[model samples]
Each structure stands twice: as structure tokens, then as C-alpha cells.
Target: MKGAALDTPHIAFVGAGNMASSIIGGLIASGHSATCITAADPFPASLERLRKSAPVAVYNDNAEAARSADIVILAVKPQIMAEATDSIAAVVRSNNAVVISIAAGVTIASMQARLGPEAAIVRCMPNTPALLQHGASGLFGNDNCSAQQRDFAQRVLSAVGITCWVDSEQELDAITALSGSGPAYFFLFIEAMIDAGQALGLNADIATKLALQTSLGASQMALQSDVDLAELRRRVTSPGGTTECAVQSFEQSGLRKIVATAMHAAADRAAEMAREMG
Candidate 1:
């Protein structure tokens, strides 16, 4: 192939915050050339911090960074997503760049309104754990996107963590319910565990550390185990034992129903946000 490296799609980041930094760090670590990336941020301090972390070109003007790029990543907060995308719309349309957005609550239609109807956009939902390179991302591309564009979008997100593609944009809301808001659910459980541990006589510090570590260990165990989660739980809860007692209490208390209700609320809210934004 002629100029294989030269053909690598140039990518521009519309915001240089924590998520952007994590994705950039992962891309560089995975051998994607830093030279092919550019980032724009209003704050000079944020730009400087990004530069310190990754040696990519930084710009104060979104258009300047995005101009003629093959891909543009929207990494700003949802509240500012429209303004950030508007600033780069002309540049993106001129180059026919594939737009990959990582912001929650912004839909493909809203983006197309800003970037023009023919704009190729891939909407994504990624959780906070992405900062630690242990995140899950769900992506959905609009009709304007080519197969290659979708693949490229997946590759960019896969740099940070695991990614799965959904058939419809609406399913992104389910993703929001699960992987998107899933971390907070786990954290809440840990908090409850910590408080209960303290009530049971462990010191505050000891309770906190033990709860956090146990959460981590359990997650790792589930991830590494070949058996299904229900089977794993059965193994942990021996017949007529303390674990069984706790498990029985949880089931009797309708814990599963509580979790189902919470996830449904999250999905509904996600859909509501998309509608409001749309």
C-alpha cells in the first residue's frame, strides 16, 4: 500500500476534558499516531494539560482543529454539545468527516440538525469508568455513515474500552440504562455495604476499604468465571449457610424488582432527554 500511514484518518476532538484525555491516552498507547490527532478547547489551561498528556496539536478554535479532518469526536458536556458541534459544522461538512459523539443525552437527529442532514454521525454512551480504561461503550451510527465510518468509530472508542454496536439509535437509551448508569448502581451498593459493615462494628475506614475491595474482587471473579452469574451466585451461597441467609434476605426483600425499577427509570429518563434535545 502506498503511504499507508498517511492514509490514517486525521481525528479532531471538540473538547479536551477528562474523557477526551482518556481516549487520547489510550489511542496513543495503542500505537495510533499522536500526529494524526488534534484537540480544541476554550480554556488554555485545559489545552495545556492535554498537551502535557499527549503531544497532539491543540487549538482554541474548533474549526481550525477540525478543518478537513477525516473524523471529528465530540467530547464536550451535553449542555454545551450543540454549541461545540455548531462551531465545527462547516469544517465537518466540507470534509465529509465522520462525527463520533461520546456525550450522553444528545441524539443523532439533533446533531444532524446542526451538521446538516447528510452528516455522518455515530452516537455513543460511555460511562465514567472509561477514565480508568475499564469502561463499556455502546455506539449507533446514522444512515449517512458508511460501513468504514462505523468501523472507524468503533475503533476509536475501543481504544479506551469495550464497544458494542446497536441496530437502532433508540437502543442507546437501554445502553444508558445499563452500562451508562450501571456504575452508579454498583457504587450505591458499595455505599450500603460500607454503612452496614460499620454498623456491624468495623471502623469507618476499615468498612470503606473492605467494601471497596470486596466489590472489586467480586466483579473480577464474575468476569473471570466461566459459569453464568446465577450459577456463580449459587456457588457463593452454600445451602443453609450465612451467605444463603443473606441471599435469601435479598430475594425476599424484592431486590431484583428494585433493580429492575431503577433501570427502567434510567431508560425512561434517557429517552426523555433525547426527545427534549431532538
Candidate 2:
């Protein structure tokens, strides 16, 4: 990718939490100058840590961070979004900068209502894998956002990982379930696999290492291979083999049904949070 398209844009992070740190790391890794970005957090320790890694400026006030930024990112917790936005709303609205929010359960409309009708809002949901630059982000732009604004948002988000754009804001809740909360499900599976391996006589350390690597290799293959997962699995599971034994156990345990149920519950909870926020 050409560096010109990603030149510093006077970006500001309203909350320098984990997600914000991931994005900041991605931006710097993607050729953006640390001097172009600024972050704000109330905690002195967080600010000190951010300052050590990047040449970016740090502020204790959200409004100070947003004052001159071309793109302002709100990375605070959803429950505190109102308070955070309220602190910087005046400056952000006055600047008319494009605002990208990673706060789960906060809608673009809610941000717009707080920032102003003219605010160009993009709502994003990125999972925890973002910390490793393997994130899956779902982006939805409000009507007021221009194509350039959307592209800019996509560029910034793509720095962290893969990005998908959604047409309807409502789909963000589903994205939250599939991508935002998806890592935990996979981690849970890995934990169970390691435990089962240990129960089968492997040492704890060996079981953990084997389970993690297996999961990684399988996921990489599933992503890179053109063949379907079912086909791949079928090729591996020879008749009456150990793999088949495990497959049968999983089938008998209703693993697929359990996963579906869990994902549905996550989606339902996201929807409930959205409704409650209103």
C-alpha cells in the first residue's frame, strides 16, 4: 500500500484503553507518524505508557484531544459514553470532524444526537483479536458521512485487521455477537481442548501448547484453503480413527447446537443493550 494515502490525519483517541492502544499500534505500524496522533486518558499510568511507545501527544482532557483532530475516535466504555461525549461534544461538534466510535452498544444515532446532527459518525465493533492485529471489524456509517469519510474510517480500521462494511446499523449487534464476542467462544473451546488433552495423559504445558497451535493451524488452513471446512474435516476423519472418535463425541454432545445457542444469546444481549441505551 502507498504511504501517501495513509499520511497523518491529526487523529485523536478520546479514551486510551486497550482497543485504542491496539489502533494506535496499528496506525504507527502502518506507516502513520506517531506525531500525527494524540490520545487522552484520565489515568496517569496509561498516559505514561502510551507516551513511551509512540511520539504521540497525550492529554488528560478529551476535549483537548478532539480540538484540532481531523478524525476523533471514541473508545470509552458504552456505559460511560454519554459522559465522555458530553465532555468533548462542544469541540468535536464545532470541528465537524469525522467521528469513529468503537464503543459497543452505542449507536451512530446516539453519537450524532450527542455530537450534533451534522457530525459524521461511523460506528465500529472490533473484537479483542485486534490486540494482535488479527481483528475483524464491522463498520456502519451514518447518512451524513461522505464517501471520503467512510474510506478514511475503513483505512484506519484496516490498519488493525480485516474490515467489513454494513448497510444497516442494526446489523452491528449481529456483528458484535459474531466478531466482538467471537474470540471468547474460540478461547473457551481452546480451554476445553487443553483440559481434555490433559485428562488424556498429556502434561498441562504440552496440552496447552498443542491445543493453541492446532487451533491456529486449523484456522489458518480454513481461511487460506479454497475447500470447504466440511470437506477438509471429512478428509481428516478416517473411519474409526481418533479424530472420528472425537468428532463423534462432539456430535453426541450437540456442540454445534450449543455454539448456535451461545451466539444467539450474545446477539440477543447486544440487542437488549441497544434498546436499553435508548
Candidate 3:
């Protein structure tokens, strides 16, 4: 990417939380100008941490930060998203900035109502892993968003990790279930594995180290291999071996069904949140 194209746009972050800071770091690493980035947060400590890594301006007023920005990222929590967006809605629209929101369950319709119909908006779900620059995000843009606006949104989120776009706003709920809340499921499974290892007489530290390394190695292998995940798993499970016995136990216990039920519950709750937030 040309440095001029990346650095020319002025970006504003409405919240300076960890995820927001991660994005700022990424944009800078991507050759964006730190002077062109501004972040707003109520807490001085958050701003302090943000400035420790980037030389961006910090503001206590959301409107001030967003007024001249070419792109405005809404990184505030869902509970306070309305208040945050309402504070800068007029300025953001006046600036003709592309508003990219990472707050989950806050619908585009809800934002449009506050920011006016002409506001270009993108709604995205990015997980906490963004802080480590390993996040995955799902984005859905309103009709008012131009192709340029969509590209800008993609560039911003892709700074942290991978990004996928969904056809409809409703599909974002499914994405929220699959990738947005998926990390917690993996962590839970890792915890169970560690406990099982400990029960089998491995020390806690050793078990945790082994589980973490195995998770990392398996993920890297999957990413680097051409084979499908099921094939990869099958390759490790010899017939009538210990791995096969464990796989059989998991299958008999309806693990797939349980996982599906949990994911569906997450999607349902995401939909519920949209209604409640609306």
C-alpha cells in the first residue's frame, strides 16, 4: 500500500480501550500517520496508555475528535454506544466521514436514526483477540455506504486481523456467534483439556504449557495445510488407538450437538440484543 493513501485519511476513535488501541497500533504499523489519528476517552488513564505507543491526539470530547476525521470508529461498549454516537453524530455526518462501529448488536438502523439517513455506516463485530492482532471481524454496510467507504472500513479492521463481509445485517448475528464469541469456546475447551491432563497426573504448569503449545501448533498447521480440518484430525487418530478412543468418547457424548446448541444460543442472544438496543 502507498504510504500517502494510508496516511492521508484522518481517523478518529471514539473509545481508547484495548481494542481501539490495537487498531491504532496497527494503523501506525501499516504506515498511517499517527498525527492523523485522534482518540477520545473519558478516562485519562486510557488515553495515557494509548499515547504511550502512538503519538496520536487524545480528547475527552467525542465530537471534537470526530469533527474533522475522514473515518470515525465507534469502539465504545454496547451499553453506552448510543450516548457516544449521539454526542458526535452531527459532527461526523457534517464531515462526511465513514463511521465504522465495532460495537456488537448495535444495528445500522439504530445508528442511522441517530446520525441521520445520509450518514455512511459500517457495522462490524471484532473479538477481543484484536488486542493481540489475531482477531477476526464480520462487517455489514448500510446502503448509504459507498464502495470507497466499504474499502476504508475493511482496511481499518484488517489492520487487526482478517475481515469477512456478510450480505445482510441479519447474517452479522450468525457471525457474532461463530467468530465474535468463538474465542471463549476455545478457551473453555482448553481449560477442560488442562484439567483432564492434571487428573491424569500431569503437573498443572506442564499441562497448561502442553495445552497451549498444542493449540498453537494445531492452529498453525491448519492454516498452513491444504487439507480440510476433518482430514487433519483423521490423520492424527489411528484406528483403535488412544486418539480414536477419545474421539469416540466425544462423539458418544454428543459434543457436536452441544456445541451447535451453544452457538445457536449465542446467535439468538445477539438478535435479542439488537431488539433491546433498538
Candidate 4:
């Protein structure tokens, strides 16, 4: 709120799984006081893990974590969100706290209906990359949420990585397919490249290292360089050179079209899940 307030707000995570841990880790790393954060998880193992690194209190019940927190993040799986919210609905409703839901396929209307009308809800789709503090999160807020509430959510999300806001909740499915599921696609590509390198006589370890670093360097360049991808490709691909040959092979194999088709399929499935959940 108010153009990114620097104050460390009290935050609570409803689920202390990997994404929640990543967010808590990023928040602490970014100078948020550990005491300002609390995590609730049903699993004893997860609570133990969170307690080891976070000075914040950990609870087995979601309602206990939501009791005194200004912001409550719902990080449970989509299928279990309704039960998770139901477990803490009374507390959240009583406090009128802002609820940020990261469960895919759970709509804002559904969340509000479950949590209560006065609940300020923000829906976000963040990928696994958040585990590495390089996530891309897409967020959208319901009418109950004020500008301040939205800003608070954005600030918390931005602590981990880039954050983008969408005008319509429907577009969240697209965002889910793009950013939420995009990392796995990149990982698959990296795996394939590693395999190809190994087939070309490189050792497994060397191939994996080269492939991973190449992906990282390429992504970094795209983020930092002013040049467009097409120009960059052309710069590296001389006529009839090795890079050009590889590019031609990829084109011939319809790699670009395949990627586009795959993304579209992912988006379609996400939309279907949203509809099903609704």
C-alpha cells in the first residue's frame, strides 16, 4: 500500500509447503523480520522444517495462524482449498484480513463465497521457480480488495521475483499456463539438450552442466539485453554456419510450432480446470 511500504507486516502462510517456504525464505532474505511471519501446516514434517529456519511460530491449524496476521496466504492445493478455507474461515472473516490464494483453478468469487463477503481476496498463480527466488507471479484482486491490499500483496510477491497484474480473473488461466507451468517446459527442453549433448560424446555431468548454464545465460541475456530475440538469433546464426544449421533443423522439425501448440494446450487445460472447479 502507498507505493510499496517498507514496513515489515505480519504475514501468515496457510500451507508451509515448498512455495510457502520459498516465499518465507525470500521475505526473510529481503530483510523482513522473521518474527513477523508465521506458517501453518497439517504435516509435522513441514512444520518442523519451517521452524528450523524461521523464527516465526508454526501451527498445525490454519485458523491459529490467521488469528493475528494482517495478511494470510492460502497455498494449499486447488483440490483441498475449500476444506483449507473452511478450516480458517471463521478467523479470517472475524479479522477481515486480506487473503492471497495461490491455488490454481480456485476463482476469486469462490474464495469470497467461502471466506465471507468482507474478505479482501487476491488470487495469484506463481510457478515452482519461486523456490529459487526467480518466479514470475500473476495476480488479480477482487472488488473487496482495496488499492492498499493489492499493493501489499504485490510487495510480498515481488520480494521473490517479478510480479504482473491482470485486469480480468479469466486471464489467470492463461497466466497459469504461461508462468505457472512454463518452468517445467524449459526444464524439459534442458533435459533434451543434455541428452543430445551426451549422444554427441560429452559426459553426462558435463552435458548437464553445459545445458543448464546455457539456459541460464540465454535467459539472463534476454532479460538484460535490449536486442530482440530474433536479432539475437540472427547475430549468432551466420549463413550456413553451425548455429544456422541447427536453427534450420529446428525449423524443419517444427519446434516453434510445437512449442506454441503445447502452450495453447496447457492454457486450454487450465481453462477447463477453472470451469470444472467453478
Candidate 5:
């Protein structure tokens, strides 16, 4: 570790895209020296952007970056993970580095095939909110991963936001449906709310601001309060009140069923991607 503490591990990112940049920025902001971080991307523009934020070493070759790192984060797309792993597999194995992947739909089994069975692997599903340091990540480790590696993976992810470990690989599919695709679900709801607000004569800017702030406040309240979400909603919904009327309308329209179906569809798609990519 060039710029980190004596025990801090040198982290290398195999992709220098938005997610990778988010993690790197979070890490640097949290006191991890930029010199201790390395980013590898095929695109010059990507590396340029990362450099503008943090003066981390940039590499065009994944293997070269992986060769000297203690932890290698596979931030590339699931479709390209196989190719990326192939390039750095030997270096990672020889160095006994922990491999943490944020690539959606790429399973531990799929990665093991390329990185070798002995490789310590942790697969995580993180949403776009990570860029804003408000993300929630779901992590799952393979049998080869040690406690230390798991902890290291958690620490790396915690830079951006909250992290939780799931016991089984299958649970990752459900996690993917929940938090992985959860941001888009909230965005869709916000969009609808804004459109309705505008329909009611509010300007677009006012509608958007109101919708966004309400969403943020509601989320913050849910996080800070001990009360259950249902109860919290109930607290705002008095009998025969406007809130109750709106809630009734949502229920009458089968909002709950629609949400459940959409989540199930997302989970099914996650599993399908694993099968296809595996």
C-alpha cells in the first residue's frame, strides 16, 4: 500500500466507470490515499475522469493492475467479466488476492470457472445510488473466501454505503430484485408523482422538487425511525382523510400486486441472466 496505512490493502478496480469512480471517490474521501488505488479501463476517457477526481494509478491492462493489488474489484459489466477475469486470473491467483465483483448477474460459480476454483470470490449487487453514497449493497461469498477477505470486501463496499451479507448465492437473485433494481422502482414512482403534480397545475420544476424532497424525507424517516414502515404510513393516513383517500385509490388500483409482480419479474430476469452468463 503506497499511500494507505501499513495494514490497508492496495485496491485495484478492473473498470473505471461510474460505479468504480464512486467507490474510489468514497475511499479517497475517507482517507485512503489515491496512490493506494489503481484503476484499469480500456477507455482513455474513463481513466481521464477518474484521474480528475483522484490521482490513482491508471492502467489500460487489467492484468498489470491486478498483478500488484491485494484486492481486485471487478467492476466491469457481467457480459465482459469472463474476458476481464481471464486477463487477470493468473496474477490474482498467484498473489492470493481477494476478488470482489459488483457486476450484476455474474455468479460466483461463473467467475470460479474463469478465475479457478481456489480463487476467493465475493459477488455484490449495488445500485446506481452508490454514486451518491446512499447505496445498499448485497454481498455473497464463495466457500473459498476467508473471513478476512469477506471483511475486506465489506469495508471496500461500505465506502459508498451500507452492506449486508447473504448466506446463499440464490438469495443474491432476490437481493438483485430488491436493492439492485430498487432505485429504478423509486424513480418510476417519483416520475409518476411529478407528472400527477404537474397535471394538477404545478410547474415542472416545483413538481419535481416536491416529489424528490418527499421521497428523500420519507426514506430518511424510515431509516431513522424504529417504527415499521406500514405503521409510519398509517400514522400519516387518518380515517377518511386525504391521505387515506389517496391510499385507498392506490390499493383500489392494485398497486401492491403490480409491485409484487414487477419485483418477481426482476428476480426471474436476474436468475435468467445468471444461467445465460454462467
Candidate 6:
């Protein structure tokens, strides 16, 4: 909290990769002081990139940076999460810091196994859009977490975008399927729309522009409007209109069923991954 507000707790990042850099940049841009932030990564390239992102202190050793931090963000890959957590497990426990992890499939149980049963840990699943400050994060805190720690976790994630807390850790699997892997679904839809537009005779550039704008505008409408999604769709599907014809085609092709199957598959895979990681 050296350069930040008096009440702001010192935050340390365990990794300095792209996602960590993005979150650090957003935090500083929002209000957190660069003085209150710190990062540790073994690679000089990674630390250099993080230093470029924010004016935070850098360290080559994990414990050196996490030594005095009030919150430690685990931003490493799932496969290496155990090793990363072990590196700073003592510091996290000694400082009694709230550990927030952004690695998907790294369960709280797995972290507790390394940090101890009484350790406060929050597991989060954040999609790539977080780099653009439009992310949706799903968080689940172990029973050891306090109310204040939960709020702090929410604030940290909110610097990137919105956050939702799951009542049970198990629900995070579905949340992962919905928002964690959700961006790719939208991207695929946008790509399909652009291709359709091009096939319908529009040039690629124009089609791409139109498709992106339409997607953005429609999302804004859904977010800002008070009406429900089904009602909004009904408004566009006028009887015997082109939109109606398209809707009919989608229904005839069982689009809803297709979506359900894909989402369930994603959720199941997420659960399987967690088990595999452990």
C-alpha cells in the first residue's frame, strides 16, 4: 500500500504472463497505485513484459514478492499450479493473505492441499475478454475465506469486468461452460455471420464490419433493456418476415438442442479437467 490508498492492501502476482499483465494494467488504470502492486516470474522476459505493463516492483523469486503482500494472485497454468502454489505456500500462510487463483481447473481443494486446510483461497474462471475490461468471472471461495476477503476478491476481479459468486464450488463447472468458454461461442457465431454475409454477395471487409457491429449493438441492447431475451427475440421475428424465416430454419435444425449439447459437453470437460489436475 506504499503508493496506493492507506486502506489498499499490497497485491502480488505469482506470474507475469498476458492475463496477469492485463489485470495489473487494468487495476492501475482504474485506481490502484502501481506502488501497491508487485510481480514475480522466473523468466526475465515475463518480468520485463510485466514491468512494461505497470510500474510495479519485480522479483525473480516468488516468495520475495509475495512476502509482504496482502493478496497473492495465482496466474500460472493449471498444470503448473501445484508447483507455483508450493513456491509461495509458506508466505501465503505466514501472511494470512487471501490467495486468488485465475487458473481454470485448479480447484480450491487442490490449493488447500498445498497451502493447508485453513488457508483462504478463491478459485476463479475468467474468459479472455478480461483483457478488454469486459470479462465475466466466476468465483468460488473455500469455507476458510472471510467476508472481507470475498469482497476483496470481487473488487480485484471487477477491475477487469463483472464477477459472480457461486453458492457451491461444484457450480463453477457450469459457470465455466457458460462464461469461461462463452467468448469462443460468440466468436464462432460472429465468424459464421461474416461468412454468411460474404456468401450473400457482400465484400469481406463490409461483411466483417457489419457482423461485428450487429453483435455489439445486439449485446448492448440485451444488457441495457429491461425486457427478457425471449421477448426481445419475438420483437424481431415478425410474422412471415425474413427474421421469422431465419428463426424457423434455426428451430427446424434444432439449434437449441445443439447449443445444449455443446454446453453440457463443455461443463463435463471442465469437471473432468479438475479431476485430472488433482
Clash list (residue pairs), candidate 2: none
Which ten residues in a row are the worst by lDDT in model 2? 1-10
Better of 5 and 6 by TM-score: 6
lDDT of 6 by residue, 90-170 (tens): 988888888999998888888999999889999999989999998999999988888878877898999999999999888
Q: For model 4, which pairs clash? A: none
Candidate 1 stretches greater than 4 Å from native: 1-7
Report the C-alpha lDDT of model 4 over 1-278, residue by residue, as the tens digit: 22125366678899998899989999999988888898899899999998887777999988888777778899999989899889888877666668999998888888888888878899999988888899999999988888778888998898789999999998888898789999889899999999999999999999999999999999888888899999988887899889998999999999989988998898889888888887
Give the per-residue lDDT of model 2 (tens digit) for 79-123.
889988788788776766788999888877787788888888999
lDDT of 3 by residue, 176-258 (tens): 99999999999999999999999999999999999999999999999999999999999999999999999999999999999
Quote the positional error of residue 54 for candidate 5 in Å: 0.6
Instruction: Flag regions of model 6 displaced more than 4 Å.
Output: 1-6
Whole-model alpha-carbon lDDT for candidate 3: 0.91
Off by over 4 Å in 3: 1-7
TM-score of 5: 0.96
Would you list the C-alpha lDDT of every candidate in the order shown? 0.90, 0.87, 0.91, 0.87, 0.90, 0.90
**RMSD for each model, in Å, please?**
2.1, 2.8, 2.3, 2.3, 2.1, 2.0
Separate clash counts for every candidate: 0, 0, 0, 0, 0, 0
TM-score of each: 0.95, 0.94, 0.96, 0.94, 0.96, 0.96
- Please provide the root mean square deviation of candidate 1 (C-alpha atoms, Å): 2.1
Instruction: Write down the TM-score for model 6.
Output: 0.96
